[model samples]
Target: MAEQGSGGNVIAALCCVFFPGLGQLVQGRILAALVFAIVAFGGYALWFFIVPAIIGFIAHVWSILDAAKFRRLS
Candidate 1:
């Protein structure tokens, strides 16, 4: 079996990598994703060295994981 949300998940993950929250929006995880995105972006605005990259990496990993998990859902 391929996966249910594999496509959306991949796209969302990529979006989040490029921007953020966009992945969550694609995954339909609006609230948490949006919040995470905002915080990550805001923090990055002030300190664009370590934290932002870490946050963005986390968000990307999260997207891939979420997509995999989506397979078990429906």
Candidate 2:
């Protein structure tokens, strides 16, 4: 919303800690939120497989970092 490392980004990153994509939603990125949610959850749903589980974990972490690093175009 403001800039990278801003308070809003910090809060968004915290939100993502609870659930992947929640931070994107907080940042008003509907498409990104949906994409992250689907990818992370889809991988998680197939957690019995090692690769998918790892993918889910990576996606979750990526979502947090993405939110934390996001900078508005304006």
Taking all chains together, the TM-score of candidate 2 against the true structure is 0.96
Q: Tell me the tens digit of each residue's lDDT in model 1 across 31-61.
A: 8577767776665665657777677566555
Query: Which run of 10 residues does model 2 get worst, by summed lDDT?
Result: 49-58
Candidate with best TM-score:
2
lDDT of model number 2: 0.95
TM-score of 1: 0.58
Please, what is the whole-model Cα lDDT of each candidate in the order they appear?
0.61, 0.95
Count of steric clashes across candidates, in order: 0, 0
What's model 1's lDDT at 44? 62
> lDDT tens string, model 2, 1-74?
68999999999999999999999999999999998888899999999997988898899999999999999997
Off by over 4 Å in 1: 1-5, 48-74
Q: How far is each candidate from the true structure, as Cα RMSD in Å?
A: 3.8, 0.6
> How well does each candidate superpose onto the true structure, as a TM-score?
0.58, 0.96
